[model samples]
Target chain A: MLENFKFVLSHTTHPGNIGASARALKVMGLSQLALVNPSNFPSAQATERASRADDILASAQVFVTVEEAVADCRLVVGTSARTRTLPSQLVTPRELVELILQQPARVPVAILFGTENSGLTNDELHMCNYHVCIPTNPEYSSLNLASAVQLIAYELRLGFAQTPELPEQRILDNEQPISREQLSGLLEHFDEAMRKTGYLKQNHEKQIDIRMNRLFSKANLTHSEMNILRGFLRSVLYRCQ
Target chain B: MLENFKFVLSHTTHPGNIGASARALKVMGLSQLALVNPSNFPSAQATERASRADDILASAQVFVTVEEAVADCRLVVGTSARTRTLPSQLVTPRELVELILQQPARVPVAILFGTENSGLTNDELHMCNYHVCIPTNPEYSSLNLASAVQLIAYELRLGFAQTPELPEQRILDNEQPISREQLSGLLEHFDEAMRKTGYLKQNHEKQIDIRMNRLFSKANLTHSEMNILRGFLRSVLYRCQ
Candidate 1:
């Protein structure tokens, strides 16, 4: 699955970028880099820039055209540093992850970057299913070439990695999320406890009751948490009654 | 909230990256920039790279130490491009935004980046409450500095544009997240309770006790949750006899 994603740099001007792109891909666990019509290649600078990632540069395929580079890829995403005059389906780097995940099969996926002077040619961008624009300063959207590769590669890794976790919120051994029935029972129980305490007033009853619903939903009361809240609510109800 | 998020670059080698960073921050609608021991600043190279966003470079704050740069910040996040030998509370860049947004008030925030070549020192990383790792290829993770700023600043903007979403996990009631001082007190309470119960054994005591601190800290216990835990501990202490 990881191997399906390819980074294609079209019309790259600098040899260092090809090397750096190779490095960026390697660090993010992406190996496939296709460089199309690069101004320089097999230069000492590319190898020097690649540092330890010379293997990636050595393995990188050269293409005569963008179409040839992305030929077999099912989904292609282009990176645009600026908002184009021509509008297209644009996704943030994070959103691109979600889009990729929704793909039914592990088809060949390519993320394209343009040359240093100008971004992807109109034809190259037109080949893409979506454009992932890294948000940058509007006045000076001068994101360095290798830097763009890093950001896109980072997003790909983040997408492949599981969603960020809140460790404390995960249920412990033998604890479960509260079921819908339990949730209903909880809301009813809250109503009774609030009524007993005379906290649910005449005019404010609907608003207060709505807020209670929202709060409990937001709290994500696990079964154990529900039990604790119920125990506290029972204690309150008993005292008020 | 974006106004309070300061991008602190430490010992930056390139004036252009620093200048580019100012543009990155400004483009994301954040004005504050702080530099800690940059190699060169007030350079024409930075101003030239910053383009029209020189106002950001003009007003950027400089500090001799990371501590001074982040002294006023309630939240300090240090960016590390790779995993380090030293362990830290690592948060994904997206997660950092959520955590920042969850802050109860608008406190100054510092996001630190290390020099272009070496990245942040272990000491610098140690200063942060959370370390944000931008996923890179393990083989070649040479991310350019300013791009790091752009990605993080973009996250901050995304965080702010988002409709004040409370993760389903956060306790939604009146209970506030306890202060660090309160957390310290709670840790002490747990330690004392464990000692009284004869639960902390001799050889394992230090490791077990420290782990316990981490567990509760990660839990982000709400006021009521802390009260419940403390009450349980008190009950256990009462039964220690």
Candidate 2:
């Protein structure tokens, strides 16, 4: 799903911003980047800023106009610094993610970011169905061009990328929940141990039984946890004898 | 509430990263920044990289150790490159935001980022209640320090900040739904116009009425839309005469 997104920077002045934008996209698992009439290309400054994301810069497509850049895109989104008087619906970056999710058919989405000083031009904004504005400090909204790309790419990653399970979670996946029979046997063991240890008084036996059952159910003990508990119970029973 | 959160960079090597981090925080409407033994501060390079967020750099607190930096914080979250073999709960950036939302009392949160080469140390990870790992391309997870800050700050902003209404949406707030009586009158006008145009036949009058009613109900037309439709109907009725 992330492959469907292509970030298009139109007439970006800073070569470093272009490089940083490539790095940003690569870090978020996005590879496609389109340049529309950039001031400089194949610049050393860009490669230096890109760090090890030179591959993204190498594979980046360059076009003469924004029209050609997003010609094949199904959904064109323009990033604006502020709201404008236009028919295009304005949305927050977060809301834009939801919009993309709702419209799965709108693949090969192109997100347009204008020059550093000014955001998307009126003509570019007119082309977009929605204008996404990253919420910033009302006083100082000077977000770096690369930072803006990083922000939008981050939102798209969160929206579309499937989160891989942690190593610990994968390890724990091997341990299944104990069966009902195993749980009942463990409960019986607990009952015997409690009786022998004089913990389960005759008058409160029913209460203890109910509470223990509820506790075990709440814990949802796995096979490994049940083994540990059963071992502890066996030790307690041997000690009581 | 953003003021309650602080970004702490420990033993950072690059001054540019510090400056960029400050800019990142400011862009996301966060102020507090604490550095632990940075290689260089009060450097011209730092200010240059900070763009115009000099205020954040000037107010940044310098700490000798991570413990002292987070002493006042109610919650400490460590940003890690990968999950470790520790007991601390590991979570994605999105999950970390949800965790913060769940624990409203855990204010004054401190998010710790380790050196560029190495992420949070085991000792630092031990201090955190939760370790948030940004999901990146497994093959190339080389996210820049400031870029990482930007991504995390972006998520925090989206999680906490209330999205302001767009100017267009605010303008549309004045448009109220037409009254039921007005809708009925409009329906009557539509019926008369259809009859005059011979579009509504004797045998299919009920069908036309039902379809028109359903279409109008589905549209949920605003007062302005109602007025436009009424004007169009009036024009049609005059033409019939």
Best by lDDT: 2
lDDT per residue, candidate 1, A26-144, as tens digits?
76778899989888987898998686788988898999999999999999899987888544589888898888889847479999999888898888878888999987656567666
The reply for model 2, stretches above 4 Å from the true place, is A163-241, B162-241
lDDT of 1 at A86: 46
Which candidate should be chosen as best, given DockQ against the real structure?
1
Instruction: Compute DockQ for each candidate against the true complex.
Output: 0.16, 0.13
Q: Which residue pairs show collisions in model 2?
A: none
Cα deviation at B76, candidate 1, in Å, is 1.3
Which digits, one per residue and each the tens of the lDDT, describe model 2 over residues B1-241?
7888999999999998999999998988888999999999978888998999989999999999999999999999988655558558888888989999999999999999999988877789899998888887777788889988887887787688765534344445324566778889999987776566555553356655665565456345556556554554565555456
Question: Looking at model 2 chain B, which ten-residue stretch has the lowest summed lDDT?
Answer: B165-174
Task: Label model 1 with its docking quality class.
Answer: incorrect
